[model samples]
Target chain A: MAHALEPQAKTLAETGPGASFGVIQGLDPRMRIVVASVFSIVTVSLSTIPGLIAALAVSIGVLLMSRLPIRRTLKRMAMMDSFIIFMLVLLPFTTPGDAMFNLFGFPASWQGLWKATEIALTANAVILSLMVLVGTMEPVTLGHALHKLRCPEALVHLLMFTIRYIEVLREEYMRLRAAMKVRGFRPGTNWHTYRSFGYLVGMMLVRAIERSERILAAMKCRGFSGRLLLLQEFNLTLRDYVFAATLCIVCIGLLCLDFA
Target chain B: MHIVDGALSNPVVIGGAIAAAGGIAMGLKSLDLDRIPTAGVLSASFFVASLIHVPIGPSSVHLILNGLAGLLLGWAAFPALFVGLLLQAVFFGFGGLTVLGINTVNIALPAVLTWIIFGRLIAKGTPVQGAVWGGIGGAFSIAATTAFVAVSLALSGDEFLPAAKLVLFAHVPVMAVEAVLTGFAILLARQVKPELFYKGASA
Candidate 1:
């Protein structure tokens, strides 16, 4: 029953559209990831409307420079916006403050509106920064960057393997779902439905474990060590440094404005 | 229940991150070399499990299955869930990187707790008994996660109290659904591959 609800993973493009040709894409993947994360921290820390607006502008500017696929980004933003919209609707009535308006005789406060705006703007700002910076780099590159940044080696390896096998497992799950559908399995709130879905997930895990054994054997045959060694090396160039500096300065300026 | 970025106050976020870091370090230390592949495979299972949505009364909610992960993996559930959350943030943007620590702690802590509370019961019981306990652990973990998420939000500001209450109320249905689902899953695993549960016990 749960298998019926599984959505396919998004098919990643060779290089994400619009991001392929962007100036940000030209920077080191490590630099982009670090800077984007720093920017996101700043955005999340923001409380003031003016500070949030400034951060949103910076995010938009980066998005325009990155030239990421606008339609896709907007679609994702719309999905996230649903939560923001819910918060906005609820906050006004629930938050106690100087009443700014009334909806159906319910008091809506200025403070509520401001808080919602802050949350919505900050969410957008951080998301846009991620779309431009982290979204542009390949997953493997990002994994390598994380490894280089001295993240736990086990974690790095686990991330890489998970990425490699997610699609395989999803495909396996789809096949099982198709088979169940052929047998006229319909999802409902019942014991049979729950048991069947449980079997499906249990079967998937069984297959995954077996496949991992084969994978480990194959890696050993190829002289694989416990640590992952990448052939590609990243060097920070002058342009990369400049990009980092500019992003940091912009973020720091936003923080200062919030204080001001 | 993922807490989105910017929703949490600095102290809550920072505190969650530190506590989560400690959990992950402990998880890493407990993760043996032989179990690395199993950890990765289970992590992927968790990653893909979120795509499975269960339709309840008026709406549908995706499966978290953190309970199943914990029942099988024990403390190792930490890194597995962290990786899944990381990928979800990067690819789907369901949660953001800045709030990863809080989100991880909220979701995974209950999983670890489930193991602590139910691990022995599940290991020692008959298949039916295991299934019953699994259901309790499943429902209990979701309830715990909702509380953590609510606390994280309410701690941020009084303005979020309503949202906090709503978050808990909304998940009530999900809790029941996951309870049934997890119960059945444990029954199946016990019949076919009881070793999975015992492995966690020994660990």
Candidate 2:
């Protein structure tokens, strides 16, 4: 898991238009957020096998055309597969159903098994589709999306600031951890060590707050407006309308197939 | 704990979105500029803290600073959390886009509740007790919320017993670690930058 996150972190550090598809990459950041958010909602609402299959198909089609590497995208999906699978495995035992097999002198119901399998598949499919959606979108795009959604200006500003300071706080945490390692501070199940960790986190917060204050102050000193400058413009182009309509049509078609 | 998109039902996911938006609206109503940096820093802390995963018996769990969030930000933790979770969902795919709202509520609700309860508890001027209870509150609040999340997921017509037990049991050690970390963080604030805890100490 740690290994998986490292590449993602690196990928994030190396973000640029050259690294992503022209459409997804070029779309206003806010628009991408809106599209991704809407797509995710549409994807998760799908439960039936056919419905999920259609959503998964649309997601995969998007991914293939998005210009991102399939290997990297699959790795992202595979990284999270374990946790979703772990959650899914429990479905068969818990969902009500007819007997399938005896486990430790208990009958495992067939109905339970089928229900579990369906739910598991649905969960995995939805998760995978959503992963593809997010994996293709950028953070700035998401912020822009929230802004467009009429999210409060204060909230939008805070999110932007939070993104700006992620690296700074991350650096502080690394330095602190290294210091702890140098001090031979191996945290055990002891009160003293626990207290030390808490102190580090609290102190980190204080330092972060101090740094943010200076940063915000410096920005304000430069005639900072309440809004950060967003340069990208996304209009309702023919392509965007086509994309939305096709998505709805595909989703509806899948629902019909499932019921049929 | 990041929830990936499509992992939850649409209704639950949509409900979470509405709730997160509502929480942010209420939080915005009470915003002060002085608190902006604190909120931003807390969001950063929340993001970074999630990256640190302590090993425990074949499964490793990371720190979630929702408790710390409550201790510092109180009511405003909600919007900070909503945005943070959304960011995590987008960049890391740690949680899914569909379930962003639910995941945010799961983590932020405890922090908000802790703030409500701990706000009064800490105001009594007992640093040590405050830190201790704050630690306890942080620990139990998250655990309680996780349990609720599991049970809710189970009851969502998608099987219940095994999954619920697995999730709840898996979090036991994680909660302990959180308590310890939250406790120590507060204690440190008391000692070095004591003003973070008490207003007129040295600010």
Candidate 3:
């Protein structure tokens, strides 16, 4: 499912307004990692309405500056919002605070709603920041950044393989799923067929592993090295410096906005 | 659910990070080259489990065999999960870097429990029965771990209840899907990969 959408996501991310502002399109993966980590921390630490609002404003500003088409970004944001709405709906009924109203046997409180809104918004912020970070950065570059951070070597190796194989797996999954669909394995809305659903997963897993083994064997036959050698130049040029400086300035500016 | 970095209470993230480090260290200490096939198969199986979804209510959820992983790999599931989630984070962005530790613990806890349960039941001589328990054990373990994660997030006092509940409730349907899928997965192993379940069987 995810594999099929990769090309679409990659294009939308690159061509969208977020990409246009050069926020995600130009930054080094290393710097994007730093920025994303910092933003997430700051967003989580924020509690008050003013603080959240300020953070939201900065994120929106960055999105706008990315120069990707606003409509494309909005469409993506809308897709994300639908998922957020599920959480939003639960807040009014389950959360307790200063009562705002009694609707359909549920007590809706102003405080609860406000807090709920914050949760949803912050969740959006987290996803949005991540979108920018990933959209702009290359996968291998990010992998290197992880390596540079002294992340476990085994983990790095495993992660690199998983990412590399995800596309392969996705393609394999699609073929199997399509085959199942053709075999009339329609998953209905009923619950009884869920058991069969489990069977389907088991079969797919077996097939995937079988396929991976073959792939692994084939690679070995070719004397495949474990590492994926990146061909991109990693020189820290003047442009890279400027990019880092701008991010720092933005971070400082956001902190000041939160404080002030 | 992948817990992103900066989402958890600093203490939870930091503590999880330490525990994960210790777990991986332990895994490496016991690591044998012969388990390569087991690790490879289980990892691939784990990856595929997430692809097929079981429809429930208004949403759909899929099988994720952190429990089965634990049953098969025991302590080794830690490194496997850590690696698996890190890959998921990078390739699909299903999770993030900072949340890697939390997600690893969430998935590994079940895998370890399943391993323990598998050990006990498989010793009883009925491989089928062992597989059944292993399946249920895997499902319940995942649910328990998920709930624990939810509670931990709520306790972080970041006004996380709504977000937490969203996650918890979403899994209600997913938990059932995982339960059924786990059972079926174990059944397949019992038939075709019986050597994987039996201690002395030749691979």
Candidate 3 regions off by >4 Å?
Answer: A5-23, A65-86, A92-96, A104-106, A189-192, A211-233, B1-10, B24-45, B57-59, B79-100, B119-127, B157-173, B198-203
Best by TM-score: 1
lDDT by residue for model 1 (B123-201), tens: 6769989999999999999999999999998998888898889989988988998888888888877888888778777
Full ranking by TM-score: 1, 2, 3
lDDT of 3 by residue, A62-144 (tens): 67766655665555555546644655676666666777889887788787687666765565565566655654454555667
Best by DockQ: 1
Query: Would you give me the overall lDDT of model 1?
Result: 0.81
Give the per-residue lDDT digits (tens) of candidate 2, residues B57-155: 555677787877866776678888887776655554455666667777887778878777665565345567767876787787778678767855755
At residue A181, give the lDDT of candidate 3. 81
What docking grade does candidate 2 earn? medium
Write down the TM-score for model 1: 0.94
Could you tell me how far off, in angstroms, the CA of residue B109 lies in candidate 2 after the best superposition?
A: 1.4
On lDDT, who's better, 1 or 2? 1
Model 2 stretches astray by more than 4 angstroms:
A1-4, A7-9, A27-31, A187-193, B1-11, B57-59, B123-126, B198-203
Off by over 4 Å in 1: A1-10, A13-21
Q: Report chain A TM-scores, every model.
A: 0.89, 0.83, 0.78
Per-candidate TM vs. native?
0.94, 0.88, 0.80
Q: Write the per-residue lDDT of candidate 1 for residues A80-159, one digit (tens) a residue.
A: 77755766689878889999988999999988888777778887788778866876677777789999888998888888
